[model samples]
Target: MKHPNDHYYLITFQYLGFRYHGWQRQPHVKTVQGMVEKTVNYVLKDKPFKVLGAGRTDAMVSVNNSAFQLILREEVSIDKFFKALNENLPPDIKALEISKLSDSDSFNIIQDVAEKEYLYYFTYGEKMHPFCAPFMTYVREELDIEKMSEAATHFEGKHDFQRFCESSDSQDDFVRSITTCVLAENTELKANFFPKKSYVLRVVGKGFLRYQIRYMM
Candidate 1:
């Protein structure tokens, strides 16, 4: 059933975050939210709409899959609206799926999300191809894959990640648990620009403090 006052939509999309400043919109800054909202406004033909992201991603951080909650003032053809969004959004941003949201859900994506998975792709040793900059981090230093893999295990289980995250509120609980933490070969994502061999630091948890993944790498 639909709410009488509003229409809620959940849009799943992916983007290459290399050129964008970040997810949130800011005056005089290029941001993912800015681009998305601009395209949405154009597609709606100036009809009023609001967008809320499931979470925020730092600049240059690419996500394989992510979502945003869109609340439209008026009802629209889901198929038509989905296509219009894809047609207007930039090539770097792609919409994968769209679904109607129920009133009972409260249209709150952040609270609904139970866990998040992050993959930090990197390649060590020789310099990486310039084209790979957006998708992976290049490390010139020789990394001991064996040792790194072992050390990654230490991050498993519960611990205070206060040192790993960048937090303005120091009094907040920094303790968190890692359901999965591993340094593994990059087989999930492939590209012609990718190196012959690449690695990815995959982390999964209920939540993560700001910049924790970057600090881990």
Candidate 2:
């Protein structure tokens, strides 16, 4: 059942995804949601608050284009929220955009979110950059770039996706649409420090199933 306080707001933010366990604040460990919620309370001067994310991101995953909504007692100032959010939030988590929700009074953020986007980075070679190891998962074995590209096209449109999704007791419908699917490979990004190399595989899509990218690579 949906909560009575279903009012929603669209929050845009970026995170390192390295230090925390994941986006959802689990009872056991550090997480992005835990940090964000703690910050919201801190900025509000020690008042408890709640929030809803489009979905949860698993451990060791980062997001540059993440969206969520917060339920707070005090009125939120967009500019002030943006500036102060980072103050209480950890260095890894940064708020980019905060759009006060506009919809029916009972709109549920989880159900109302239209879509989401995620990108995974691949780094090759021996010498690694400071951020590379933490930010990117390493792949040295030769993967069929052309084959990966072909596979990406297959993922376009709708699919059962049950195979791609991580098994969960909560997952009911495994059908998800891919609005935009693209695979890129180039040598434009040359390292000035270590591992002077080129990326052979890249992918961007509207939505992703759990460990879908990891499964793909």
lDDT of each candidate versus the true structure: 0.88, 0.70
> Where does candidate 2 have its weakest 10-residue lDDT segment?
194-203
Per-residue CA lDDT of model 1 for 121-205, tens digit only, reads 9999989899888888998888999999988889999999989988885468999889999999999889887899999999998
State the lDDT at 161 in candidate 1: 95
Alpha carbon lDDT at 188, candidate 1: 85
Backbone collision tally, model 2: 0
lDDT of 2 by residue, 16-74 (tens): 88777888889989998888887887887886467888788878788877777886555
- The deviation in Å at residue 90 for candidate 1 is 0.3
Question: Candidate 1: where is the Cα deviation over 4 Å?
Answer: 1-4, 104-107, 169-171
